[model samples]
Target: MTALRSRVAETARVYRLHPPRVSLGRVVATPGALDVVRDHGVDLPGLLRRHASGDWGDVCAADAQANDLAADPACPARLLSAYDTAGGRLWVLTEADRSATTVLLPSEY
Candidate 1:
C-alpha cells in the first residue's frame, strides 16, 4: 500500500476501536479539497477520523476546547479541525446539526 493509504488504514482501525464523539451524518469534499487530494495526496479519511475522534488536529487550544464542547452530540455548535498538507492547510468541518461534514481548503472557508 502507499504510505498515505497505510496511514489512513491505521487511523481508520484506531478510530474503529473507539466510538466517534459525534456523528458525521454525511461526508463531502469541496472542489479545493479534491484538488489538494489530487495534488498533495492529503488523507481526507484519516483527517476525518481524527476529527471525529476529537484529536482536533492543528487547532489552537481555545479552538480545540471549543471543538470538545461541540463534540458532544447535544451541543449545537460546529466542529472544526485543521491539518497541514503538502499543498497547504486543510480543514474538516462538521456542521452544528451534524447533517454534513466537509473537507475543504482554509481559503474556501
Candidate 2:
C-alpha cells in the first residue's frame, strides 16, 4: 500500500495534477475484480500515472458540474472509462478538486 501510494504521488508530480489520495474500490476486493487485476497484471500506479498525464485509454465522459466525483450514484464526474490491454473495462474517477481518486470496474460503478 505504501509503495502504491508513493507511485501515485510520483505520478502526480510528473503530470502536475493535484496529488490524489488513491484507493481501490470496495469491489476490487471481490473475487472477480481480483481475478482481473491478477490476470491483467494491473499496474495501478502506472495506470494512474497514465490517466493523470491525459493518456486516457478510452474516455467515456467528463462532467465538471458534479460536486462529488468519487461517489456519484449516477455518472461519475471526470470519468475515464477505458479498456485495459487485456480488454477489461476499467473506470477511474477523480474528485472535482483532484484530491482523491478511485479505481473500479464499470460494474462496480
Candidate 3:
C-alpha cells in the first residue's frame, strides 16, 4: 500500500480496559495504518492533542493509555470507540459526523 513494507497482521484489534472490558470493530486498523493517515497530512497526533474533537467529545488519550483488543470478540461493529476513561460507556461512530451508539452487554449470561 505504501513504499514502506507493511507489517503482517499476525494479530489486530481495538481495545480499552481500566476495568477489564472488551470492544470490537471490523475495520480494525493498526497504529501503522494510522501512521499512513498521518503521512497524508492528517494531524493524527492532533487527536492526542485535544481531549475531544468539535462537539463530538472524543477524548484524546496519551501513549500510556493505549491498549490492544485484537483477539477480543466483544463488539463486532464497523468502528471502535471509547470514553478514554470508561469502558462501560463504550461507543462506535457508525457514520461520519453522526452521533455515537452505545455498546450494550446482554445481562442474560
lDDT of each: 0.84, 0.53, 0.27
Question: Ranking under lDDT, best-scoring first?
Answer: 1, 2, 3
Residues 10-108, candidate 1, lDDT per residue (tens digit)? 766877787678788899999989999988877677678788888777799999999988887666699999987668889999999999999999989
Off by over 4 Å in 2: 1-34, 60-81
TM-score, candidate 1, is: 0.81
For model 2, which pairs clash?
none
* TM-score of model 3 vs. true structure: 0.20
lDDT of 1 at 10: 71
Using lDDT as the measure, name the better of candidate 1 and candidate 3. Answer: 1
lDDT of 3 by residue, 1-109 (tens): 5322121111111111122233222222344434444455433332221212221123344311332222123433233333221112222232222233223222211
lDDT of 3 at 98: 24
Worst 10 residues of 1 by lDDT: 4-13
Q: Which candidate would rank higher by TM-score, 1 or 2?
A: 1
- RMSD values for the candidates in order, in angstroms, are 3.1, 8.5, 15.1
